[model samples]
Every structure is written in structure tokens, then in C-alpha cells.
Target: MNGKQKQSYKYDKHKQRLFIIPARITSNVNNDILVIDRIYDDDDGRVVVLDREGQVKWTYQGNPQVNSGDKLFNPTDIVITSVGHVIVSDVNNHALHVLSGEGDVLTCKVMEDQGIIFPMSLDIDTKGQLWVGCHSGDDQRKDAKLHVIKMSF
Candidate 1:
């Protein structure tokens, strides 16, 4: 078998829209594909989850209670934990959003309170610690930080 497009999902929950811009995608153990769709130039976006059949399972448009105004959901990267939970990087909001495998918004972990900002990338360690690769938002300083956080939920 050569290179061939299996299925293209432009819009979630059906129709083709191509609304996803610069998408970051990953698959969980359940064969569900998680995509981080950066929609706007301002880094505003949402996470779209689809099944193996290329059908939209559910869409999480950010938790309204936690995200609004300047602090909207701007997901840049995504990863599925060992337990099948989804962790999304909200760089602009300096936070990480944890979603259930079914696309339910579980918790919003605000990293700013713990002195972490611009959480760009994520990975889970062998010991189950979430490693966050971050970059300083300051234009003048091109610095980076790595944080390991152990979470339970």
C-alpha cells in the first residue's frame, strides 16, 4: 500500500469545513483521534475528537466557566495519558486542560499560579508526572522551562 488519504475531517459532528488551522493530532488507546485545532490568529481554538470511522464523537469548546474574554481556550498541543485522559496546552491562558476520553472537560489546571507560563508542549513520564515544556512569553527573552507535575483526578 502506498501513500493514500484515509479520511479528511474538516468539520466536527459532520460536514466538511476545514476550519482547523495548524492542527496537532494524536490517537488514544481507544482509537479515538484527538485534534487541537488552532482556529484564529490570536491562538483561539478548540479540541475536536473523532472516532476511527472519521465520525465526530464530541467537541470540547473550552469550559465557559474558566475561559472567557482574554483568557480563551488556545490549545496548541495534545497528549493522551495512560488512563486515556486528554491533556491540552492552553498557552495563552497559561494552563492545561484535562478532558475525559469521551470529550468531557474535566479540569482546568492553571499553571500561572504555580509560576508556570506558556506551557507549549506536554509529555507523561514513566512515573506518571506530566512534563510541560514551556517558553517565556517575553519577546526580549528567549528562555525555556521544563516542569514536572504529578496529578491525580
Candidate 2:
């Protein structure tokens, strides 16, 4: 071995099949990973969570407390805030949904007016702000824009 100390870095390649849309990924403070479930035509889809060891914890399926009205869609991408709140991009309905730990809708708002057509992915910064990636359909995909929605809670 060289006299100089070798600073080594390594990453674990633990794979777990949880969500459909595996294009984007985010990690919580606890190293829990959140991935997009799938991409839909009209709205956001679902987000799945995986523990540090690459084990499925529990998925937040679009606010489990909200009663389905027969015209509701699931979440596309999810973000776990520093405060432990789950933020989801509810695409089909053209909105962003915030849920509590137990999967209850804490707040919901239409992100379409903000040029958010179909939110497909989400990312959270150190300051706890949400970065949203929207898809305006394949025809306009080349012009798709990224929306940054600042979380209040």
C-alpha cells in the first residue's frame, strides 16, 4: 500500500421493485428512497418508498384517507420534507397534494396554472422546497418546463 492514505468511497447497489416510474429518485433524511410509480397521460401517478436497506416500507398511495370519488387519480412523484411530511405531485387531477404521515390530505392545490401540466417527478432541496418536473405531452415534450413549488409547511 502507498504511504499516502487512500480515501475510499463506495455505494451499495441494493435494488427493490416498488414503483413503476423509476426515472426519478429522492432520499429522505433517514435515507429512505421515494420513487415515482408511473407516468400517466393526464396527471401525476404514484410514489413508493424504500428503506435504507432497499426494503419496501410502506407506500403513500395518494392520501389513503381521501375517499375515492370515482374520478380521482394517484400521485406521480413524492418528496419527504424535513418535517416528515409527504409531498406528492397528483398529476391526473392537475394538482399537488400534501399528506400527513398517516396518508391524510393536508392540503391540495392546482399546479396547472403554474405551467404544471403533468407532474412526473419531484425533488426536495436542503431548505425543504419542492422541485417539480412537468410533462406537457409527447407533442410538446421538447418544450416541457420544470416547476419549482415552495412548500409552506
Candidate 3:
């Protein structure tokens, strides 16, 4: 197949809900488009989910309780589970956000205490194990690590 651009979407940043610095874009098993939008250079990010028709389904802007004080959402990667649930990595906060297919906040798993300093990317293997790519403290580039966890829906 020839590599060619098939479709594109554009939105005015000031007029509508626009995509600001989209880091990663993917689709779920149900064909729902998921995007990690970085509002700033590396902070204040959100997850924008869209339907196959390019219609805005829902958006997640980080849980308020988790980003209250000095912490920012800082989403870096996104993945959808086999059951269509969404998983997002919050590098700034060192946590993985699990959400329902309809965009409800199911739970937040903080892995900082477990030595996962900066969770950057996520994926679910065929066996349904959750794979997390993360970075350690000061020397993130040199000390990056990948962890696999057995997760059940």
C-alpha cells in the first residue's frame, strides 16, 4: 500500500476545543480515537477521545484531587485495554489513570512509591499484561526502565 495521508482534522485554538501539541494518538479496540494533548511544553495535559466519525466523545483533564497543589496532570502516553478501558500516563505526577470507556474516572494508580518515578507510556499485550515505560529521577534518559504488570479488568 502506498503511504499517503488519508484524513486530517483542524481546529482553531481560540474558537473550539483544539489539539495543542498532540504527543501520541491511537485508537481503541472499538475504533475510538484517543489523543494525549500537552497544553504546555510538558505540563497541563489532557486526554481527548473521539468517535470514528471525528466527533468529540469525551475528554479527561486530570483528576482535580490529584493535581490540586503543585502537581500537574502532564500526560505523556495513552493506551486502550482489551475491554476498551483507557489508560493514561501522568509523568509529572508519576501515576497511571484508568478510565471507563465512557470517560469516567475509575481509579488512579500511583507508582512513585514503588520506584516508578515518571511513567511515560503504556500498552497492553495480547495476554492483557500492562506494560509501562518510565524514567528514574535525575538521569531519566540514561536510567529509563520498562515494567510489566499483570492487570485484570
Give the TM-score of each candidate. 0.89, 0.59, 0.89
Candidate 1 structure quality by residue, lDDT tens digits, 28-98: 99988878777766668988777887777888878776688777788878888899999998898888889
Q: List residue ranges in candidate 2 displaced over 4 A.
A: 1-60, 63-72
How many residue pairs collide in each prediction?
0, 8, 0
Deviation in Å, model 1, residue 26 alpha carbon: 0.1
Pairs of residues at least 3 apart in sequence or in different chains that clash in candidate 3: none
Model 3, span 27-143: residue lDDT tens: 987787888888865778889887766677889988887876778888988888878888999998888899999999999888888787788878888899999998765663588
Task: Report the C-alpha lDDT of model 2 over 1-153, residue by residue, as the tens digit.
Answer: 778954321222454344445645777767667666554433435566666666666665564334156435556667777777777777666677786654466887776676788776788878776888877768645877787767787
The positional error of residue 117 in candidate 2, measured at the CA in angstroms, is 1.7
Better of 1 and 2 by lDDT: 1
User: Local distance difference test, per candidate?
Assistant: 0.83, 0.65, 0.83
Q: Over the full model, what C-alpha lDDT does candidate 1 score relative to the true structure?
A: 0.83
Those runs of model 1 whose alpha carbons end farther than 4 Å from true positions after fitting are 11-14
